[model samples]
Target: MARPSSDRLGYLLVAPTVLILLSITAFPLAYNLWNSLRHVVLTDPSSAGFAGLENYRALLGDPQFAQVLARTSLFTVVSVSVQMAVGLMVALVLHRRFRGRGLVRAAVLIPWAVPTVVAAISWKTMLDPQSGVLSFLFGVDTAWLAGEWTAWIAIAVADGWKTVPFVAIILLAGLQVIPGDIYEAARVDGSGAWHAFWKLTLPLLKPALMVALIFRTLSALLIFDVIFILTGGGPGDTTETLSYVTWREFLVESDFGGGGAVSVLMLVLSLVIAGAYTRLFRLDRREG
Candidate 1:
């Protein structure tokens, strides 16, 4: 009886928070799902009718949407991979005691603290062929955003510069929690630095690595502000991502059904990526 009462009390304590979360998240999601199934064109209000997955069918088979999806996937993979590698390197460097380590860490984190739009704008100016610092230094007047691959590279670099620091901070925290005794023991066993790091550090760092990967992957999937500010999906829509397509559908073209479907797809993609990471890393299971 006491256990049941305690559980009831626990539920009562959490009920308000649960309701609040549902009100904010569940309500909007339900609304979006509802809209995704109906043809609610802003221009053709009278033509609004039940779409019944028609919007999804059209968008899924859309060549333009297909291209955007591919670009978004590629961007996510490249951005997350680069961020993880660079972040791991930084974390390793910072894990060691050095002169002005605090200052160096803080300096590295400054970019992470900067606003996304501001960073995007700054990078755009730097990469601009006319009167841009990078172009001036290289002594070439080629437009970076005008090229297909160069445009993606520019966006990835800007995003990586702003985000790699966050990954490093997370990884650094993971590195700090590791016991020094273990490394000393490895050294006693004549284990080289590379052997210890490869055998011990990476295995222990899986949790943090998965976390950083998922977060950065999700951010890359929904990437819009940076691309919007830098390129605006220009150069023949080659730079447009799924999120960008959704915005164009809903806001630009006023295709409510199509936009809502794309938005739902994005939500699904995020969940899938997060779930895959969690499962791949077995984050829930305790290491023996």
Candidate 2:
């Protein structure tokens, strides 16, 4: 055989990585898509057959799914917004030159470093109605996770507590890359801190914000671990997210086809949110 060019050699070198990705990710995705078009109720093995678009159509027509999607959207929106706002504050504080800043930064990361399930379980224990810390301290014995709305709040609080530090870390990275000279110039021009942040910091931090938003939004939309540990979509499906619903279908109900359809829908929702953020921020364009 003739000697391969550098380009060809590069492709050959990358081929293994590409193949590995296809095997792990693409293969499962393809299989899920295939399954979504069929009947896959585990209780009815003999019922498996091609039923093009039936799963999708039935899912769309499901009022319960509609409720689940809306709740998921609400959770994602509220959690991401809260995380970003809190993260921005923490990032600003971390960016400041102060004593013990290093320790503070590391300490902030503890929650993020902890495993999600562990953190959720810890929160669940702490929020227990009868004898939990909150109940003991407040002296009212309010059941934090008993009611529908309260359970959602408890889940959001737990998720936010665990993930806010991560958002802070990302935002801090973005904040550091910004040139100090720009802020100095703004100050010299009589721009107040609030004004400068609104005009300069936000615009400059657009790239990082977009990245954090996409990550957190996707995480929020697909939120399951916290819900699983804290609420279990219980109290009559009040906290039922789409990801939880998918899990219920596949494992609890043993309807692989329906679960596959929901998985596809989740993927589409993620793509749509990512695309919206990219377009909203004009992320691809070079700012002159």
Candidate 2's clash total is: 0
Tens-digit lDDT track for model 1 on 141-190? Answer: 99999998999899999999999999999999999989999999999999
Worst 10 residues of 2 by lDDT: 279-288
Q: Which portions of model 2 miss their true places by more than 4 Å?
A: 1-5, 283-288
Best by TM-score: 2
Error of 1 at 173 (Å): 0.4
For 1-288, candidate 2 gives per-residue lDDT tens digits of: 555687799999999999999999999999999999999999999999998999999999999999999989988888899999999899999999999999999999999999999999999889988868998888878877879988988999999998899999999999999999999999999999999999999988988888898999999999999999998888888999999999999999999899999999999989998899888777456454
Q: Could you give the C-alpha RMSD of every candidate to the true structure, in order shown?
A: 2.1, 1.7
**Global lDDT for candidate 2?**
0.92
Q: List residue ranges in candidate 1 displaced over 4 A.
A: 1-16, 283-288
Candidate 1 positional error at 207, Å: 0.9
